[model samples]
Target: MSQSLDRALTLLGSLGDGPVSLGQAAASIGVHKSTALRLLRTLEEHGFVHRLSDRRYRLGGRVLSLAQRALQGIDVRQVAAPYLAALHERFGCTVQLAVLEDDEVLYLDELTGRWSTGAGLPDRIGRRAPAAGTAIGRVLLAGLPQDGRAEEELPAELAAVRRRGWAAESSGHLETVTSVAAPVAGSDRRAVAACAVSAPADRVSPAELVRLVPELLCTAEAISLAYGGSPTPRWCENRCGARPVVRASRT
Candidate 1:
């Protein structure tokens, strides 16, 4: 069973190049076509592979979902590094840029303390943070699509964060850690990523963190706009100054 599972994983990894037919998958796995078909069926049932109408198979929406989340998270890291670096230098605390992934917040990049020498925080490039508790999670939860068909569990607090345009947690997810976060929006005014600061709750009062909200919002908006996406629903609706918001609604 273990050997078969390993072989199946190997076969699935090959699909990254492009779609393949049943015979191709079988050949790649060194198995009979019948055996490949059975393996594909099992993988399809688990949302790993999707069969097209023409009988060729490709990575499924489940896979694409993971990929999209990774892209958004990485994009934020790319776009927000300078701002985060300056912010960390000013605030003298660790900063993180993260995005939602499967009901969790994944850190894409982080800037650590001067005294700490960037060695304490885990290498969280692809790690997941609990979506229910972190400030970034709250902002992302708030900005996600609210329809019943939404892919993730969008709780009410996250929804409220969306309406309010920012989120914060005081020792909510981690003991002694307080974070203030803001959403990064796409052209739809929907959030595509999040930016946050993590510090000792006692050192940074809620009022001080609240004061940072506008700056964080500006940073997020700048990144979103730099990516050619709308910064907010109000921006999309023409409530703020800029070129009239291009409607991101899929016609």
Candidate 2:
């Protein structure tokens, strides 16, 4: 590696521990204060570091923002696969992981329930669908910024999803299908993805689907926790209450 580039990276890594004085940074990177100042100045210009009132340097806001974005971009399918598979195993319903991208729901991964031959499911991995029209999409959109939305201005269906902490949808054009979805949040408490269970209505009736809310929520919350977020506040208060969740074992 070029000496300058190596020194620059070393300086940034040191700042991760905490704020560092100019002399401290120089010593950590085996460079002079002048060199450290130049490195810090360059990083500052790019929003990678910020100088404190005490003349110490610390990681800047850009680092946090970038880190959050990286977490959001993780292959959530891998993180949530076992949990989604568990739902598929227990309920015999199609389970999928979806994220919001380009104002749409993009499926990341899915498990076809054992009961079906995978004939009627419209959703497939990597497919995109309108965000507001699907159960998984509504759950994700509901978790997004409301932007000071007035009660009357917000669609009642979306408002209900936000308040209810989940969403459901039914499709009948081809075959009657029912879906229930809940949010998979990040450390920031924003829904980065949704976990959903879908099946034909004839087999899993709407009322039966409603009854599966507990399991759907449990699966979603487990995925959220595994993804480094806490369980939903309402669920934790009511059904969870500081109790530890046991995830499906991975062999």
Candidate 3:
């Protein structure tokens, strides 16, 4: 790396501790005050650092914006691929990863089992489904912060999904299909993506999908941990015992 660039990065990293004076910044990067001032001035111009009233400097809001954008661009599909494949292998059902995009469920990845070839699901990658109608989309919605939506106004089924940690839909939009979904959380314990196992109703009944709930939650938790999220909360950890096997309803 260029020596100047290295020094600048080191200086930036050190500022993360707190605002730092010019001498402290120079010492952090093993440079003289003039050299450090030059680096700080360039960083300030780029909105990477902010000079304080006392002439100390700290990380700037632009740094946070950049970090957020980088996190948003991460390819979670690659991280969840192995888990999706294993779920497909175990259940002989189609497995998918999805996120809420533009009020729709956008599929990022899928592992289709033979039984799901004609299941009539949105099995293709990049396919989008109404977020309130699909199992995975409901799970994503239930897992999200309220934003502007009120909890009391949520559909009862979606409310249940929020409490229990997963959602299952039978014959929603496509009457021949059944799908069970759970949220894959991020470091903040918010759903970053959703994981679902879908299949033809004849191949996997709603009861069968309900039975897969525990394993599905486990799979989601595994992916969440790998994706730097907190583990499933105790309430969500109860899994099979949390709710009886009920027929999945279109929400």
> How many clashes show up per model?
2, 0, 0
Candidate 1 residue 227 C-alpha distance from true site, Å: 1.5
TM-score of 1: 0.60
lDDT of 1 by residue, 174-214 (tens): 76666788877776877878888766655667777777766
For residues 117-151, could you state the per-residue lDDT of candidate 2 as single tens digits? 75566537656778887899989988887677764
Model 2 lDDT, full chain set: 0.80
> Quick one: RMSD of model 2?
15.0
Model 3: lDDT to the true structure: 0.80
lDDT of each: 0.72, 0.80, 0.80
Better of 1 and 3 by lDDT: 3
lDDT of 3 by residue, 1-251 (tens): 99999998889889867899999999998888999999999999999999999999999988978855654465677677777887788778888888898799888888887875455554457567799988999999888787767777777877899888999899768788888999988767889999998888887789988898888987887677666677554433464232222212212
Better of 1 and 2 by lDDT: 2
Candidate 2 Cα misplacement greater than 4 A, ranges: 1-73, 150-153, 172-175, 233-251
Q: What are the TM-scores, per candidate, against the unseen true structure?
A: 0.60, 0.62, 0.61
